[model samples]
Target: MNGSPASLDAAAMTNASVEVVRDVVYGHGLVHRARPGGPVPRALKLDLYLPARHAHTAPRPALIMAFGGAFHRGSKENDAFEAEGGNTSVADYCLRFARRGYVACAIDYRLVTEDPEPGTTPVVSAPERIPTSRTDVVRRIMNLPPATPDMLWRGIEAASDDMAEAVRFVRSRAAEWHVDPARIALGGFSAGARTALNVAFGEKVPVAAVVALSGFMDRADLQRHLSGFDGGPAVLLVSAENDLDYIAEATPGLVAQLRAAGLHCELLDVPGAGHFYQADAVAVHDAHGATTVERAMAGFLRRTLGG
Candidate 1:
């Protein structure tokens, strides 16, 4: 809202227009044990949502929506903000899935803090400065990490392990949530997108598909590893031309490599858009207006994950 377009607020949210009711699964937001050597301790939590009335179906698809905040900041609760409430909200997204007959889960992963103090600003011990010319400031602020590949890898590894554990935790308890363990999908915005991509391509876990929104994917070793990895899940790279310079540059090459590896991939390039389209309809308007981008994303999700 501060740095993004003003049009997003006034633009019509078509998804909000739909008439859908959902029953949320509350109190299920509990932490699961993390893999050894990951960032946060073994106590990381996630929230799950399913069509309250439709839990009897078999093999129902599930979505794991990871909130973006550069991996340093953000919570699964952020997805419930009033401005982005309703259809754009993660709850709404999952509810839409439930309405369409799928289950959705949103997870909160570990933030990159050396000594995280609750309710205090997280200070990242990284060489990179805030508001840099080389990186997207918002992303940098959210995913504040040391300016080195090793640090990034460590953060990502921790996140991947947490995410993997989350998937397994959900799968292990699939009967309770009425979800199909084999049909789980991973998706996130920005840094969360990177985590999703890493988990989907990495050998640590098995994901059916990946939906990376305004994501960055330029780790050569990770790319190389994914290139050789067999049976990796499909990917949907969603972004606008104006999303972020680094993400824009890295995604195409990643897509090319994934395709070469015989993996299923699709790139949805929105016009005139920047990062955080869901929260700001003005930015969505700036890019190609809200209707177009929302429909595109909704359609892409439906097509890739099934309606």
Candidate 2:
């Protein structure tokens, strides 16, 4: 909440609106984990939200987002299940950003496939059937009742690759979309945050910044995969005061590790919230005025991206 002031007034953009271009295919990639038969590529898509026509004459900054679902269930379209007015979904974030004269995208990525039933045929026998994993963040991380450390790593890698692809896809279409490719940032909630961090640090893609909400990688993973990480984007790490126990436990170490890598990182410890909330439900005061998640994010983007 405390840094460079917001570039725009948060309250004045109430009447702003945006247009959505949905189901646009960006590329194809294999799912988070290999199926019974082998790897199969799936279409990667995104819903682009552009500032309404005439909203701007020059290229605008872009924000590419990935939704959180523990790398299991969820889509580029929706977010944590809840009603926070227009503050709840991924599309909502896109709409808000587009209204403020920025291009935004909600992207698709591979998810884990459900285990085959005992004595039942697997996915290769029925490619048309949908595959799923009802696993949640807690289950995946703790490996509580069942151990799945390997599966967790594979899913994170797969999802991170897909997110990296999304960044590349947006950059490829920068001219057509009137986007400033160098200013693009990556963000996500919960599991999506984990994926975003992975892409920003692990991938070679050079994003301008990153906003991770209630998400982070394990300390060991950070040391193992990102020890050689060099210059990368500035980062804003948001942790819900009441976030999952494990995420809270890992945050300090994560922040320390990021800083140790010579990266400029800031932590926003959001009070009175958990893993998810309405976009504006939580507010913070900057020099500009009281700002919500939407405005804080916009401000961070503007400051880091120089929009």
Candidate 3:
């Protein structure tokens, strides 16, 4: 308050501090605290990584990150849901944004498993079925409950719906959170990536950009919640060249759709990487797997949402 006009102007131009803090809570109308110890769902909360008070005096662009678990198991810590440092985004991958002075949030979404009477087996084809499709690939490897074409799709729809509300939730607290209501971006890995795509193309929300890491969605499914509006937001898609899921389907179609709709979109192929780059390919590729994608993400956010 007692600085020269020149000094104050400089301070305003550049964020003066890098201090980081976190706030977590359920979104509006999403708070459902279960009775003391009843299988409460994983806390429907997001951890925010914020900069210093001075830096946030003006609204800052925000990013909401969803983790990928093939639509059944990822979390805010999707980068390492089962390994150490898997609970909070502040400790793992999402924390990288704090240095850049952007408020980043890692969110967890509802994951529902198909239910069937125990010991009552699922109907199997006359011949032992060879699994196919991205869902089938993940289902076999993860040993998850038997899923039908219908169930897996329902899962994606549910996750994307939550993402739409999460954007609204962040804007609802724009003043308190110091986040620019108009500059929010969405991105995620694996299944989370699919949800991000759905959030931008599948429905209407005030989104500036989208970053998808190894994710995809069907046009018809995305059409289920379409809200006619202005031009769509920019999008970036990243997938492993070896990812059985999209090397042939999804990404190609998605890129075509974005272009046909007159929207800007980019796709980066991660060579030698699998579906889960952080978990499976980082070490083998000497960090190119994750670093390249993160760099692309930073560049995309900067170009589309600005600081």
Candidate 4:
């Protein structure tokens, strides 16, 4: 943990005192395609991590996160270092934030390849109207590989909807969780980060802040969305120096666009790192001295969510 913040170390990253409630269903709906037998409702679930009860008496701020697997394969419990037999899963992030007095949730969304039936729509909130022109622009900005042939736009849309529902669900349970509804934030990595951006800017979910890692959006669309924006949620746009080409190219532009729109946006580029660093793997040199990705993320949440 070179250049690590004094408050952060490997030993203190995952707080054992945190309470995690796994597989908590947040939304229920039909799959995009029917199963072998018939169309059975799919329950969208999340793992909720609550901080240890303390005498400090303020409702905890909350974070709702989504996992990334290119919108096709991922789990709320997927450990970033599973191949190495390590226990650094999204739950580690949740636990770290929980210990700092924030309620954290890692959620599941409908994957692109979940059920491949044509013309079958899943039950979701009223679809947010996305202009065809905007979709075309986003496709160009993404610059995905030529090998995959399914509809990428559809997956992005569906995932964003699921994230919005998660936000609403957490807000609804604010009292039971002893959280502050107005202090909730959204975050994710890779594809999940893209989903968080969609919910924040596209779906217009009233969240306090957004933390997007290795993710970006069309600069033109971002500016368009920020038209007449009176100080929207603060944004932390993070990416690796060696991230995927498209992400490396677009992240800086998006950060510039957000700042030009007079919004509070920060950028953290992890030098010599790639797109898939674990929560605490990459270290960043910031005002707080040497900081890991998890530390940077937690600090951002605290600043924007009043933790």
State in Å the error of residue 241, model 3. 1.4
Please give the range of 10 consecutive residues that has the lowest summed lDDT in model 1. 116-125
Q: How do all models score by TM-score?
A: 0.69, 0.78, 0.72, 0.78
Q: How far does residue 153 in candidate 4 sit from its true spot (Å)? A: 1.3
* Candidate scoring better on lDDT of 2 and 3: 2
Alpha-carbon RMSD of each model: 9.8, 9.6, 9.6, 8.6
| Tens-digit per-residue lDDT, 1-307, candidate 3 | 1122343223223644443333355542221233443333343456555565634268888888888766666556434543322222223445566557676777766654522111111111111221236556557778865676555544555576667767877788777768887888887876677778767765566688887777666554443433354588888877676675443366777777677767878777766655545422332122234446567677778888887
**Distance (Å) between predicted and true CA of 285, model 3?**
18
Model 4's TM-score against the true structure: 0.78
For residues 98-168, write the lDDT of model 2, one tens digit per residue: 87888888888776553211111110212122112324434555463532544555566667777887898
Which is superior by lDDT, 1 or 2?
2
- For model 1, the superposed segments whose C-alpha errors exceed 4 Å read 1-42, 79-92, 114-152, 279-307
TM-score for predicted model 1 compared with the true structure: 0.69
lDDT by residue (10-59, candidate 4, tens digit) is 34335566756677888865455635776456788887776767324577
What's model 2's lDDT at 188? 87
lDDT of 4 at 293: 81
For model 1 the local lDDT of residue 262 reads 85
- Distance from true position, residue 91, model 3, in Å? 6.8
Each model's C-alpha lDDT?
A: 0.57, 0.69, 0.60, 0.70
User: Cα deviation in Å at residue 31, candidate 3?
Assistant: 13
Model 3 shows how many backbone clashes? 0
